[model samples]
Target: MKGIVQLNIVQFSLIYLLLLIILYIMKRSKINQTKLLIVASLRMTVQLVLAGLILTYIFKNPHPIFVIIYLIAMIAFSIRRVLSKNKGINRNFKIALSFSLAISGLFVLSYFVMAVVQVNIFNPQYTIPLAGMIIGNAMTGVTLGMKTFMESIKTQRNKIEALLNLGVTPKKILLPYVNNALETALLPTMNNMLGMGIISLPGMMTGQILSGTLPTTAIMYQIAIMIAICTSVCLTVFSSLHFGYMTLYNKRNQIML
Candidate 1:
């Protein structure tokens, strides 16, 4: 397979016109979000350009320390992003959430890279991109699961209290909310799996193919990535919710909020 053609600066700059079309449509619709759209577009470009430079250096270096640093940075940034949306989370819960994400995400990432891909543990080319995919999906999953679980507990406080009065264990009372949160968190992944290859070419698979990999090989990697993503998401969501719900309780085992 031939290597993909690289996009030059002129070609890249042309892509911004697409954003202009979007802004024009938003204006026509009176959405009042043109400025927000422009800002988001600028942020995306700046972030991606910086990421590309950093990744280039990291890829060339290919050191275990660099890999570890990148992984930690990804986890830290993901935690911050998740918590930013969920204000006033307790310190203990925040710690638990970070722990769950790091442990579950790294475990799945390691297993996929070593057991499935059979690459060097710190191979930058494979590890960094794969880690990004796994951690990125897991972050989204944790965010949805945590937010839904917390909100449900608050909104259904009266029902939870009733169940508590009936001698229902706190764990049992939380089972329904936990179940709902997991479903909400995993639904997007499930839908993607269902539609993959048919409805859309996934980003990873497309990138691989464009980079001169065989379609069959790219498909294999995509399948492995999807499995790793689902496993990491499930583990993170379950662990985070389990530990998080405990924090929502007082010393007397009553609901905190």
Candidate 2:
């Protein structure tokens, strides 16, 4: 098979013209996202370009320290983004969110890299991109779970208080909400999995195929990564909600939120 064809500047720039169609549609529909669309497109372009540069350098000068630093940065940024979306959470809740995301993400990523891929953990070419995918998905899952859990608690405050008065344990009362939140968090990943071959081609598989990997090999990696993502997401969301709900009640067993 031939090597992947590289797109030159002109060819790549032409893709931006497609964004004009989106902008036009948004404007005609009176959607207030024109500025957001433009800013997001520009930011994505800049970030990916910078990432390419950094990745090129890292790939050339691979070191354990560089890999460690990159992983830390990814986890830290993921935690920050999750926390930023969840305003007014307590310190303990913040810790839970950060801990779950970092721990679960790293654990799954480490296993996927060292166990499944059988590569040195410090191998930047594989570790960095895989970590980004795992950590990014975990962050998204935890965010959605947190949002759903918080909203459920707030909306069902009266029911919770009633349950508490009826001598129900906090764990028993809050378990359902946690379960619901987890289900909500897992749905997108599950749905994506359901539609894998029929509805859409996943990005990782497409990239590997484009880079001249065998279709069978790419399919295997895609399947493994998808499972890893789902597991990471499940662990992170469950941990966050499991530990997070405890923060909602105190020693008196009264509903705090």
Candidate 3:
């Protein structure tokens, strides 16, 4: 049977109303947060409605090209999010991060859905949602990592130049900044893993149980997703750094960014 919680729209609406009440009472932040909240809610509802219709049609078609096209769209959306998050970054940095996220996300996700699961047909049902998760997480990692790295290097341009004058390699001079950026990027993923079951109910696992999957099955998928997140995060961070550093060092191997 479909779980009873799925039909409890009234109860959910009550919680939403209570949240709105709390926001109204708080009265902090100079911006019109209440209006923002209302607009966000409306947009969310419309987006979900459209997504449901599109996904239904996609599943019926069952074509590999279209599934991949949807994945590309998701990745593009994610890149835009990254660009917005790190405002004022160089244009080349944006392009580098985009390529890094695309490559790293696709590599990890393909391994998960193809080699690990070995599912036939590979319909949109399994591919799209999981790919979205991987892409979203990887985008965060790449963007944060690249943005932080750029800021750190730019701020420490003097140190980098001194190292260059001292005949140190570009990568060697940037080592500390790169390491810190990677750590910063991975911190949220680590936090999520640490607090997975206790502090927050993850969306995918909660949905699975709500749809009648056993508790154990939900936990398994959650575990797999966490692993995939880590994998994707690491790959994206390294790739962005790997290629991004190239633009900074010139033909004479001097630090230039």
Candidate 4:
């Protein structure tokens, strides 16, 4: 196979024309998001470039300590981002979320890296990217699940109270909400699996193909990654929802408002 075609600076710069067109259309529509769009685009460029540099270093070094530390930072950042969206959530709930994400995300990541991909656990080139994908998706799932679960509880307080008064257990009363949250959290991943190859080519597969990997090989890797993502999402959502609801009650079995 021939080497992959490399883009020149001019060619790469042409992509920004699309962003300019978006800006122009937004301006014509009087939407007034020019600054926000510009800032977001700038941040995306800067962050990805920085990540590329860091990842390159990590790949060369291949140190397990660095990999471990990076994973911890990713989890910490994800937990912070998830908790920031919900001001009403307490520190205890934050701890639960951190624990849930760390456990679930790591479990799936370990299985994928060690068993499926069969890469060295400390191999930054393989482990880092796969871990990033799994943890990122799992983080998103936990955020969605936690938000939906809390909202369901808030909106269904009367029903919950009535059920509790009728001698229904708290867990039993919250089962429906748990189910709803899990369904909502997993919907995006499920939809992606359903639409893969038909509706859209996922980023990883596209990257692999661009880097000269065989299409079939890229597809196989994408399938494995997607399955890992789904499993991690399910585990994270279930664990977070199960522990999160417990934070709503006290030792007396009374729900906190």
For all the candidates, what are their Cα RMSDs to the real structure?
Answer: 1.5, 1.4, 2.6, 1.4
The digit string of per-residue lDDT tens for model 3 on 1-257 reads 45635547686667667666657675765455777777888899889879989999888888888887898899889988887886665567667878888888888888888877767426788888999899988887877887788888889888888888999987788778878899899998998999999998899998888888888988988999899999899988987777767666778886656
Question: How would you order the candidates by lDDT, starting with the best?
Answer: 2, 1, 4, 3
TM-score of every candidate relative to the true structure: 0.94, 0.95, 0.88, 0.95
lDDT of 1 by residue, 173-203 (tens): 8888988999999998988899999989999
Each candidate structure's count of clashing pairs: 0, 0, 0, 0
- Model number with the top TM-score: 2
When summed lDDT is taken over every stretch of 10 residues in candidate 2, the lowest stretch is 248-257
Which residue ranges in model 4 land beyond 4 Å of their true spot?
A: none
- Candidate 2 matches the true fold with a TM-score of 0.95
The TM-score between candidate 3 and the true structure equals: 0.88
Instruction: List the candidates ranked by TM-score, beginning with the highest.
Output: 2, 4, 1, 3
Q: In lDDT terms, which candidate is top?
A: 2
Candidate 2 deviant stretches above 4 angstroms: 27-32
- How much is 131 displaced in model 2, in angstroms? 0.7
Query: So what's the TM-score on candidate 1?
Result: 0.94
On residues 1-257, what C-alpha lDDT tens digit does candidate 2 reach at each position?
A: 67799999999899999999998999899999999999999899999999999989999998899899999999999999999999878889899889999999989999999999999999999899999999999999999999998899899988988889899999899999999999999999999999998898899999998999998999999999999999999999999999988998888886667
Worst 10 residues of 3 by lDDT: 1-10
lDDT of 1: 0.89
Select the stronger candidate by TM-score from 1 and 3.
Answer: 1
